[model samples]
Target: MAHLEPLDPKVDSIRILTLLPRVDNPNSKELFCKLENRTLASKPKYEALSHAWGPGQATDTIFINGQKVVIRPRLHDALRSLQTGKGRSLWIDALCINMEDTKERNDHVNMMSYIYSRATKVLAYLGPSHSAFNKADMKEMGESYHYFSERNCQLISKSIYWTRRWTIQELIQAKEIRFHLGKGYFTLDNRFNSLSNASNGSWLDDHLERIENHRNNMHSHLQQLEVLLEMFKDLECEDTRDKIFSLLGVADDTAQELIEADYDVDYYQLYASLIDYHQSASPLQCRSDLFRSSTYDPEPWRENWQGFDVSIERSVRVIAFSNLVQKTLNSAVNQTPIPESLSLGDPIIARGVIIGSVMSIGETYDDYVSSWESNKKWKALLESTYKKDKDLAKWRENDAAFYQEMLKWDHSEVAAIQSCDTTKSYGYRESQDDEHITREALDSVTEGAQPRRFLGTKGLMGFLPPGAKEGDQICSFWEACFGVVVRKLSEDRWMIVGRATVSKESLTPAVTESVYHDALNYGTENTSYSSLLSRTGDEFWAKQKDLAYEALIFFKLDIPTLQKLTA
Candidate 1:
């Protein structure tokens, strides 16, 4: 391998690979390439490579400047495909960044956003092409709608190329993007144009249209963070911290400040900082125009808010009321009496409305034992055994022995039952019933401590606050996705118990009414809950109210109006 030059931090310099064209032989052991370092200030024109570094240990040999150089198999394939009759200039990370040098890696990473954004074009490599699309077939499918609908393309969409945290910014920040599928390259823009030319009104076109529209609707940095977290939650990275750091370049300026990329910081600290930033950020604002205007829907907002399934109608109503309240505040500022139809005493008028609640508080230890025994048919078997033997004492005394004899159990069970006389033990015994057993164990443990499992109005689950008993209200700010567990400290005050999760399902009207009543009953006697709002401050409350109102108003709109607004 040719001696690689160290990157000079004094000036912005990057290595561009000069890919040699393929020879006639297909089984050639080696490929040739040349690496040249150039300063970005000179405006070097080169295509950037965007790909997932699959299985770090798997590498292929390539000839760089007539010397053997080791490179990732994926990158070697990319170079072989991208090379043409004339050598192609490409800036690939594996070849470009000096991986052995930590300082070089850091500098290169920090400059990555700018590097990709300034690239002449970005070739998104989605690994080897599926056997379904050979050279002849690929040639015919070029820029066609069929090309995108191909199984290979679908695989490309789900590829690690699209899932990596670092590539999110790479794709979004690129000056232009092209897909390298095996040996074939194509542009999505060409596919869209081809579909437009056909005007066939196919489902593909409709889907593409939605995607284009969504892409056009650019999100703010904070909003992008929310989207990234949800979209890439399942993505893997060697360094857990890279999950957040990789996003800094593409993230909005404000969000970047919230989480500056620091490899030295622990991953948990990085995550905590992000949550803290979100919590401290001002609540959503209610736009009066959103209520009066017919073009609002709450789906986008709700999706952004929690990235969970939400009730469109309920979200819209909450937003409408929030917007209405904003108007009322405006009217009061102008010395006008609030409209009678929208009076403060109206049924809808409340400090905050319950959006969701926990499905079950939690199962007690007794409940857990009963459920398990019932599920396993142990209750009946034990009863029949006692009746047949006519010996209840033996049944109770040798319960573990009887359980082991009755059913095929595992080592864990044997251990758990043995420890039953001492410490608590719980775990899944089978793969199929793993989820069920895990949930039961979790519920049982929490319930044992008198912790009630409650859901936020918006469908989140968490425990009630410490010292919070059952039936205590779970309350949350309209702008906040999570809720708090609280009980009336007095007629006028409410004691904070701690945090609780939002429920996945919407609460029934009766449940909603009951929650409202509980809050109102205390609210009317004393301003404790009102003071709760005050704790977050009037500015924060107002902002939350506005967001809630906009969502509600959007929910009330007709489908056509909603589509038009979103469109």
Candidate 2:
């Protein structure tokens, strides 16, 4: 009906050039028009018949005007074959094969996902889409042949293998942490490894001092010195005497230096009392006791030799100094207990008292408890597990109900899926009605009691309640549906924290099924698919929250821990 215009020779030359191997052909201005008309033209009833063939015989193509675009030989042959077949025209790349051309191959390879996305029915070809296979074989094979064979070796070399290795291989091949092993057991990057192995640096001196002060005390140091002296008493001869003198500061030089200087204690009895005192005190007690015992031993007064009153005075002075030192030592041994409130029924307060009391004796609570409870049968079991596994104690100590609920919910959801009958649920009344009709027919013939007509379930049958059905309560109910709130404390974000189950019912059926049925319909029709997923999303998150709350009640965690988490 419209006038035909003559085509320019220059335009015709350009159109022909577009189909060549390396020609840069701009996209047709009318390409969008063809795309938009695709759905409209692709309806099954309006499909063209090839005298005997179905819509499947046609090849889908983007006709710029009306001329057939001259693509490569393989694709051209495929299009021609599709034009004669009974199968619906699927414009996917697997159907069109220009396997010889690298450039065309690369372009198509990138668009594979898009090709499947746009297809009327993505004929996920199993082996071959056109292959005449039986239904059994097709089902078994799956729709694997639908994927286009990728021959873009450059893309594979550059993008897939090289890029993937650069991103992920290092992490996958990295070393694991074995803290119980030697110091260099775990190795990550060179920097991290170096950081771990670095010295007990100058920055740590203050911390070291604090730690030393915490454990070091005058009375314990004195006790240790006595033990060390007893150990040295078993050593032999003049060498032992010199070594003892050097250790106790009676000698000027260390044993190694004295050996180098050829120093030896010839008159061992002159320092006999010093050696005896050093032998009495331990190693820890030796250094502190050195000055008073050996270095500053005063001689007896001249009057003491003649048995005069001066002898009594010298004895009295000695006794007074000894008494003073003994009193100071005794006071040091009796340390003050850390002040703390022993509030009744408070587990933290009880645990604190236990921890503080035990920590006074040992380096850590674990070390102290391991020693204190070693004889118990429960200790054997705990050690057996704790030695082999780190998480074992945590697993046992955790609320048993947390895992129990997880397994319970997992099985319940699985069972719910297995028991579901979609057709029956969707058409419950119709199916029941048909069943009753068939039963009545059979009953009349057999002369049994007449079968009754099927009646709908008691609660819901499109019947309105005594009042309105949809209102604020219903909207509020939907709003409160299963979801989790991720609350942020410092921020003013009011997140509905934790997993919640705000369904029509939980663990039990609702008292009124009418509200429940309406909610179910609303959920199925109105809610997004993400809102309905079973696990790991809003619904599952909400459920987890509720389960956590149940665990808190069941486990009876202390108020402080609970308050801290919720806050």
Residue 412 in candidate 2, Cα distance off native in Å: 56
Worst 10 residues of 2 by lDDT: 350-359
Per-residue lDDT tens digits of candidate 2, residues 1-567? 011122232321100111112123332211110101132223321111011111133344434234433333333332333232132333333224243544444344333323332333321111112222232322111212111112211111121111111111112111221110101111122223233344432222232232233224322332232232332332222223223322222112122221221122222221222322322322122331322234322243122223332212221122112222222222221122212331112211000000000000111212322354522433343344345454555434431333233234432222111111011111110011211111111112222211110001111111111111111011111112221112111221111111222122221222222222222222232333234333344443353342221111001112222111111
Residue range 446-497, candidate 1, lDDT tens digits: 3234333332222333444334454455544333333444443333233333
Question: What Cα-based lDDT does every candidate model obtain?
Answer: 0.47, 0.22
- The candidate that wins on lDDT is 1
> lDDT (0-100) at residue 291 of candidate 1?
26
lDDT value for model 2: 0.22
| Model 2 stretches astray by more than 4 angstroms | 1-36, 39-66, 80-87, 92-120, 124-567
Q: How much is 284 displaced in model 1, in angstroms?
A: 6.4
